[model samples]
Structure formats: structure tokens, C-alpha cells
Target: MPRIPAVPDAEAGVVGRLVYRLARRRFGSVPEPFAVARHHRKLFWAALVSELGWERAATVLPATVREIAVYRTATVVGCSWCVDFGTMLQRLSGLDVDRLAHIDEYATSPLFSPAERLAIAYADAMTAQPMTVTDDQVAVLEREFGRAGLVELTQMIAVENMRARGNHALGITDQGFDAACAVPQGRSLDGSRTP
Candidate 1:
């Protein structure tokens, strides 16, 4: 259970209920964060809008690179909820989630591509306590991803940091999103199987 209890559907106002219904339709359940955020109406809407905006705006980098960096940040922060949700997202995107087992050895792991390694390393630097991000790291990322892509990468990492830390502090652990909705083998989010 979270340190702060999630608002039950009964107590959720009209807008909250509508949001919860939409969430359930989209994610198979209303995410605990949304339930908890419902307590503060303005902040809840702000967070919702911010999330949607980022989702639409963050299209510069390849999903694989962006997702790996976000997942690495979640692991580094030790946020179980973020890790669980990130895993589900990756799987839905048709990425190989099995390679996540080797994330600890990302620096030397053959599972990750060169671009993934760079992004993962950047995530580590950004998530460090004192923020160990370096000029060389940014320069290399810039050279690889260009200015627009680099910006999107940075924003994704920073956003994940905020989410992971917040969820950790709030005592929000994994809600089993990955296990609850298993995408069938070779199937995509649209229910179409890929070749």
C-alpha cells in the first residue's frame, strides 16, 4: 500500500470518475498515481496535461533509445512502480523486454546497442545524487542525436527522474501492470501480430 492511500472511485468526483474510466479503458486499470493525485484537483489536471503533452512532443528520438534511458533512470532511482510501468510500456512497443535482465551490465552487455549504451550512461549521470552529467557526455549525445533529439532525450530522462523520485517518496510500489496485461507473442498494442 502507498504511504498515501489512493482515492476510491466512490469518492472521486465527476471529473475524477471520468478520468478514471478513461484510464481503465486505456491501461486496463486506473494507475495508482492518478488515483492518489485526484486528491488535489488542480495538480491532478496539471500532471495529466503535462504527461499527455510530453507524450506527444517527445517524438524526436527513437522509442528504443528513449525508453531504455527512462527505464535505466527508474532502476537507478529504485522506484519499483516506474520500473514495472516502464517494462509494460517497452513490451507494448514490441521491444525485447528479456534484455532488461542484463541492464545491470549495460556498460558491457551485448544486449544493448551502442546508442542505447550512451543513453543509459546519460541516464545514470543525470540521476546521480550530485548529478554527474558531463560536458563530454552531452557533446557525444548531441553528435549522435542532434540538438532536437538530444533535447527530447534529456527531457525524457529528467521527467522519469521526477516520476521515480516522487513515486519512491510516496511509497508507491509496483502495481503489477506488466504481469496483469501480457501482450501475446508477436502481437502489438493494436492487437495485430507482427511478422
Candidate 2:
């Protein structure tokens, strides 16, 4: 259970219902963060808009690189919800989720490419206490992804930090997205059977 109870569907106002519908459509369930955020209408709306805008924005980095960095940030931050959700997203993006088991050895792993290793290292530095990101790290990332792609990567890592920290503080845990999605034709976040 979260430190704050999620606002139930009955209590969710008009805007909440719409947001829930959209979230259910997108992620197979309304994320706990969304359900909890509904307690504060404006905050919920802002979060929804920010998430939607980020999703629709174009990025230059390959999905694997960006997602690996984001996933690393979540794991480093100890946010179970982020890890579960990130794994699901990575799977849906057609990336190999099996390699995640070796994330701790990314620096020496044969599974990760050179560019991916650098991005993962950067994520580690950025996620460290006091943020250890360096000029050289940014320079290398810029070379690999260009200035625009570097910016996108930075923003994504930062956003995951925010989300992971928030979810951690709220005592939010994994919602079984990985397990749920694993079940063939399983129920969605809304508890409706997926075809």
C-alpha cells in the first residue's frame, strides 16, 4: 500500500475519469501515480500533460540507448515501480529485456555496445548522490547522439529521477506490470481481459 491511498474510481472527478481512461488505454492500467495524483486535480492534470508531451516528442537517440539509461536510473534509485514499468516498456519497444539481469555489470558486459555502455555510465553518474556527471561524459554523449540527442537523454534521465524519487517517497512498489503482461491474454491495469 502507498503512503497515500490512490483515489478510487468513484471519487475521481470528470477530469480524473478521462485521464484514467487514457492511461488505461496506453499502459494497460492506470498507473498508481496517476490514481494517487487524482487527489490533487491540478497536479494530476499537469502530470498527465507533461507525460503526454514527452511521449509525443521526437528524439534522436535509439530507443535501446535512451531506455537503458532510463532503466538504469530507476534501478539505481531503487524505485520498483519504475523498474517494472521500464521493463515492460523496453519489452514493448522490441528490446531484449533478458539482458537487464546483467545491468550491474554493464561496464564490462559484452551485451552492451560501446555507446550503450557510455550512456549507462552517464546515467549512473547523473543518478548518484550529489550528481557526478562530468564534462567528458556530456562531450562523449554529444558526439554519439549529437547536441539535440544529448539534451533528450539528459532530460529523460532527469525525468526518471524525479518520477522514481517521487514514487519511492510515496512507498509505491511494483504493480506487477511485468507479471501481468507476461500472462498471455491477461487482464489489463483496469482488470479487463486483454484480447
Candidate 3:
């Protein structure tokens, strides 16, 4: 359970109900964060809109590059929920989720492409205490992904940091998204979300 209770359906107002309905349709269940945020209506709506906008607009970077960076950040931050959700997203995208087992060896592992290694390194830098990002690293990324793609990659990584940190602070755990992915199609592992 989270530090605070998730807003129950009985307390969910009209807007909250709509948000829950939409979340159910999109991800097959209401994410715990969304339910928790609904306690503050304005915050809930803002979070919902920001999440939708980012999903719709974050298309400039390759999915592998973006997802790996975000996944790396979540792992570094020790956010179990983000790790679980990221795994499910990567699986759904048809990426090589098996390679994640070697993620800690990304620098020397043959599992990751050069582009992925660069992005993962950048995530480590950005997520480090005091932020270790160097101008040279950004320049190399710009060359590989172009300015637009680099920007998208940075934004996605930063957003995951925010999400992971928030979820960690709130005591939210995996919510079974990874297990959901392992189960047969059209079924959820814990009846929370579908793979």
C-alpha cells in the first residue's frame, strides 16, 4: 500500500471518474498514481493532461533510445513501479526485453547498440547527484539523434526521473505490470493492468 490511501471510487468526483474510466481504457486499469493524485483535483487533471500530451508528442526519438534512457533512470532511482511499467512498455513495443537482464553491463555488453549505450550513459549522468552531464556527451548525442531527437530523449528521461522519484516517495511498488506481461494475452497478472 502507498503512504496515503488511493482515492476510493466513492470519493472520485465526476472528473475523477472520467479520468479513471479513460485510464482503464488506455492501460486496462487506473494507475495507482492517478488514483492517489485524484485527492487533489487540480493536480490530478494537470498530471493527466501532461501525461497525455507527453505520450502524444514524444515521437521524435527512436523508441529504443527513449525507452532505454527512461528505463535506466528508473533503475538508477530504484523505482520498482517504473521498472515494472517500463518492462511492460518495452515488451509491448516488441523490443528485446531479454537484453534488460544485462542492463548493468550496458557499456561493455553486446546486447545494446551504440545509440542505446549513449542514451543510457546520458541517463546515468542526468540522474546522478549534482547531474554529471557534460557538453561533449550532449554534442555526440546531437550528432547521432539530431537536436530534435536529443531534446525528446532528454525530456523523456527527465520525466521518468520525476515519475520514479514521486512514486518512490509515495511508497508505490511494482503493481505487477511485469507479471502482467508474462501472463497470457488479454489477461492481467493482478487484475490491475493488462500487458
Candidate 4:
């Protein structure tokens, strides 16, 4: 359970109910963060809008590159919820989720492409304490994925940092999203066990 209880659907206002409905339709459930954030309506809407905007705008990098970088950031931050959700997203996108088992060895692992390795390394640097991101790293990323792509990549990593940190602080662990992907029909969006 999270430090703060999620606002139950019955207690959610009209607008919150609509947003929750949309979330359930999109991701098979209202994310715990969304439910918790609904306690503060304004911040909830801001987060919802920001997430949607970023999802639409972040199309500069290849899906694989963008997703791997974000996943790497989540892992580095040790956010179980982000890791679980990221795994499900990667699987749904048809990326090689199996390769994630070798993430810690990505630098030398054959499972990751050279480009993926670069992005993963960048995520590590960006997420590290004191942020080890270097001038050379930025230059390399820029060279590989133009200026616009680099900016998009940076924004994605930064956003994941915010998400992972917030979730961790709130004690939000895995919501079984990865498991839900395996047997989607068996689970309900409201987190109820269905027969």
C-alpha cells in the first residue's frame, strides 16, 4: 500500500471519475499514482496533461531507444513500480523484453545494440548522484540522434527521474502491470481479483 491511500473511485469527483475511466481504458487500470494524485485535483490534472503531452511529443528517437533509456533510468532509481510498468510498456511495444535480464551487462552484452548501449549509459550518468553526465556524452548523443533527438532523450530521462523519485517517496511499489500484461484478461483495472 502507498503512504497515502488512493482516492477510491466512489470518492473521486466527476472530473476525476472521467480521468480514471480514461486511464483504465488506456492502461487497463488507473495507475496508483494517478489515484493518489487525485487527492489534489490541480496537480493531478497537471500531471495528466504533462504525461499526455510528453507521450505525443517524444517521437524524435526510435521507440526502442527512447524506451530503453527510460527503463534504464527507472532501474537506476530502483523504482519497482516504474520498472514493472516500463516492462509492460516494452512488451506491449513488441520490443525485446528478454534483453532486460541483461541490462546490468548492457555495455558488453550482445543483446543491446550499440545505440542502445549509448542511451543506457547516458541514463546512468544522468541518474547518478552528482549527475555524471559529461560534455562528451552529450556530444556523442547529439551526433547519434541530432540536436532535437538529444533534447527529447534528455527530457524523457528527466521525466522518468521525476516519476520514479515521486513513486519511491510515496512507497508505491509494483502494481503488477508486468503480470497483468501476461494475463490481461484475468485482472481488473481497479486492482480487484476477478474470477
RMSD of 3: 7.3
Candidate 2 lDDT tens digits, 1-195 = 999999988899876888788878988998998898888888988988898888778368888899999988887777778888989888888899888877878999999999889889988888887788899888888898999999888999899889988998998888878853222124232223357
Q: Which lDDT values do the candidates have, in the order given?
A: 0.85, 0.82, 0.83, 0.86
- Ranking of all predicted structures according to lDDT, beginning with the best and ending with the worst: 4, 1, 3, 2
- Structural similarity to truth (TM-score) of each candidate: 0.90, 0.89, 0.89, 0.90
Can you write out model 1's per-residue Cα lDDT over 77-103, one digit (the tens) per residue? 777788788898888889989988678
> Model 4, which residues run further than 4 Å from truth?
180-195
Tens-place lDDT digits, model 4, residues 1-195: 999999999999888899899889988998999999988989998999999999999999999999999988887777778888889889989998887866778999999989999999999888887788999999999999999999999999999999988997898888988853222223232222369
Give me the overall lDDT of model 2.
0.82
Residue 29 of model 4, lDDT score? 92
Count of residue pairs whose backbone atoms collide, per candidate: 0, 2, 0, 0
Model 3, range 104-127, lDDT digits (tens) per residue? 789999999999999999998898
By TM-score, how accurate is candidate 3? 0.89
